[model samples]
Target: MLTDTLRKVDNLMKNKFTAILVALCFCITSVNFTGLLTVSAATYGDYTYKVSNGEVTITGFDDSVSGAITIPAEINGYPVTAIDKDAFYGCDSLESIEIPNSVKIIGEGAFRYCYALTSVTISNGVTTIGEEAFEECSSLENIQIPDSVTSIGQWAFYNTAYYDDETNWADGVLYIGNHLIKADRD
Candidate 1:
């Protein structure tokens, strides 16, 4: 009878040990998977302002920023294709900007309300400037829209100050390679 009892006890202990080991392993696996999910959420959640050729598209600007900003020529190794509407709106201290040739389009209000912007150099590959692209850029003293662009949207420079003096402008008529855009409104 004693031997029989001993055998039963051993069997029970073996089963209990196996159950504990499995439970510990399951707990560890759960913790590992949870940690991985947390890392992934954090990485994808933070603010990443950019637009790329295939992966991401920038739509607009959400906050005000000061100082000059040099938008990266590429994002995630893909060339930047578009500048969305209001992309640099309310950036009061933005003094100058260089739009790279890789950018094909500039959306509406892209530089609106940039009060301190004094110069802009649009590269030769851009094709379109959307409506009100530079609206209210009061301090924008000089702008050179390249010859490659074919379309300038309505009111692109509405409510903004432009070259009142010869030194502030290259010509009385804003010319994109002999295609006159406008005459300074008296």
Candidate 2:
């Protein structure tokens, strides 16, 4: 009877150990999967960026940043080549932004819904502006599209105060070296 009781106790301990091991594994996996264990890339000034293949992409910004924000041309030896989707979305206190010449692409909704944004300086190297890149910027007064910009996605400047109908844009139209780019409705 003593041997039987010992065997039962040993089995119970083994079961408890197995359950604890399973629970630990699950917790670790959950943390990694939910990004709680991932480390963010370096932050420069008010911006955070991630680098891959020797290129940098702006990811997020510090919420306390107000007024004009200037994106640096390079961060940590990598050229800032792109702005990720929703990089500056809904930053209501940001009044303006200056994108450096190293940036080539502006991702979808990069600057959307910045209600207080009024001006933007897009340098000469940018080629593509993604969909809704500057949509819903009610206070934006004007923008100058550089000649290097080859494509402007749909609704990029929708709902802005400066938008005018494409055909009736006698004034307040986005221009690239005299070529009309967008004349969105106000």
User: lDDT tens digits, residues 82-170, model 1?
Assistant: 77788777877788888888878888988888888888888878899888888888887677888888998877866556634444345
Give the best candidate by lDDT. Answer: 2
lDDT for each residue of candidate 2 in 22-50, tens digit (9 for 90 to 100): 99999986664433232348788888888
TM-score of each: 0.62, 0.70
State the C-alpha lDDT per candidate: 0.68, 0.82
Please report the candidate that would top TM-score against the real structure.
2
Q: Model 1 misses residue 69 by how many Å?
A: 2.3
